[model samples]
Target: MSFFKSLFSKKQPTARPKLNHPSELQLNDIFTFGDSFALPEAMRKQQLQVVDINTLEFQHQHYAQIVGQGSGQQLVYVSFPNNPKKLIKLSLLLSRNEVEALFDLDAFSEIFEEPGNARLRPLTKQHIYADMIADEYIQEEFMISGYSHQQDYRGTQPPQYTEDQHGREFEYHCLEGGAGERSVDIFIFENGDTDVYLSFLRPANEITELWMKGE
Candidate 1:
């Protein structure tokens, strides 16, 4: 009788971790300084289209414009507070041939783990475009692959301004968020005192589709 009771017992749900600042979070290489330089941006403007993906009910209504093709090609450009004069973009574009290359490289794996930590594989440009067609595409292929989102400090990367408060600038990638739920926030600051603020949160799925269809 006790065994039967145990079999029917409900297990407790694990607690969610608290969000900390600067540190206290584990990050993956892709979210770090692993950008393909201008590769992502160039592909979006040339090979794939761009869109805005922000429609999740629970996500914060932050303005993000996602541009890319639904055929697994696109780039994500984010413009946020502090330095609102510039746009920071991240892109991924993969051609049919490129997809074949991935297979050749043995890049397809159900699980990615190191000695003691799980890792997320870097996306081929092709992977980025496919993600736009369906949120599920990237969600299943990349998001769920045990990779952590990046945390970009206040200042890093291009469009960065000179110090002394004359202007703002940040051009670097870092890790952010918790396991299973993570994101990469790229920063691009223009000259000081520019007026540009994005307050709409969008899901990448829909935005990428629109851009691909050229709508």
Candidate 2:
């Protein structure tokens, strides 16, 4: 009886290490990076189509989009022009409510780590959310991958600011990594709404070369 009980006993779940920064989460483990886009056999049966960005007139120039037939499923492909292998695929299955809530200050800022350490001060509503649309996307799409709860911190001190013809701009770099790197740039504008640019930069050397050469 004792032997049988020991054999059938349940094991406790192992705790994940406490993460201090977004840079500690690895993007590559959850999503395929630096690879050609291929629909899963199941998804292929649903009629996949590569939509031209020009037809959609997407404001963001860095990513290319692909859509599924009638399914609300979509993939955003990030790659250098003429180079297909070095790519990051962002899978999106967003609801209307989630999309609208992204622009809300409280909803958008919820994903960032709350400040507590002596070295870190609590972030203001504007500073906490600031141009962080990527947080919403990740929360909605990648939550199952365990990145939704990861801590994110400013990669640069004081952030960065600039002025352009349109308006004043504030830029902040938030990053997470362990197995791979995921870097995001949040661009806050005085006259316009915020914008987010996310990059999965694992296997860094190759990506750096491709980016530097404007490939």
Candidate 3:
């Protein structure tokens, strides 16, 4: 980690800008990590926030805390209850004012893709403090029909069928829930650094499979 000691320097954190997705704008060299490939930054901003839900009133709330490092540096962790996998961690490189700017609704716009062919989009600096607030929980899913329709694949060997001889073996990774539209895909952004990835549904989006994908 490098430090800027000059009295007048450009290292200062400033007001945030609107947020946007990658392939939606131009960026320097930021990257978003994904399963298939990494993407490039399509937008830029000073901070990011969590809004929509409140910590005091909501059962499923997001909590934030700042931890001090022995080296005199600090890191902030913003965690969500609805999505256990979602957490925004930040470092001392950015000032509290910059962090505050991130929470502003007007700070960010546009999207930035990660470096390779990865399909998931990573979070950006535009994800300021205000974006950290919790407003609501929108339930969503993807629906796909399975081949066997059996509840479990226990005691069964890996189903393999030749496409030419008999038939092709296919599995369904479906979505379930009420009569509303569901989210077919999930984008996971890890670390404060713009790292991103995609989450694929398997065996009807089993919880077991979802956990394994991250590791």
Best by TM-score: 2
lDDT of 1 at 124: 45
Regions of candidate 1 where Cα sits further than 4 Å from its true position: 1-63, 68-87, 95-97, 103-107, 112-215
Ranking by lDDT: 2, 1, 3
TM-score per candidate, in order? 0.24, 0.26, 0.18
Better of 1 and 3 by TM-score: 1
CA-lDDT, candidates in order = 0.28, 0.30, 0.23
* Per-residue C-alpha lDDT of model 2 across residues 132-156, encoded as one tens digit per residue: 2223233212111101101112232
The weakest ten consecutive residues by lDDT in model 3 span: 205-214
Q: State the lDDT of candidate 1 residue by residue for 1-215, as single tens digits.
A: 99998999998887535422112122210111122322333333233332333211101222222333334533433323222323232333344465354333343232222221222243443643332221111112222211111223322322222353222332222222223223332232233221111112222221121111212
Model 3 per-residue lDDT tens digits across residues 13-47: 66334333221111221222232211112111112
Ordered by TM-score, highest first, the candidates read 2, 1, 3
Which of candidates 1 and 2 reaches a greater TM-score? 2
Per-candidate clashes, comma-separated: 39, 7, 64
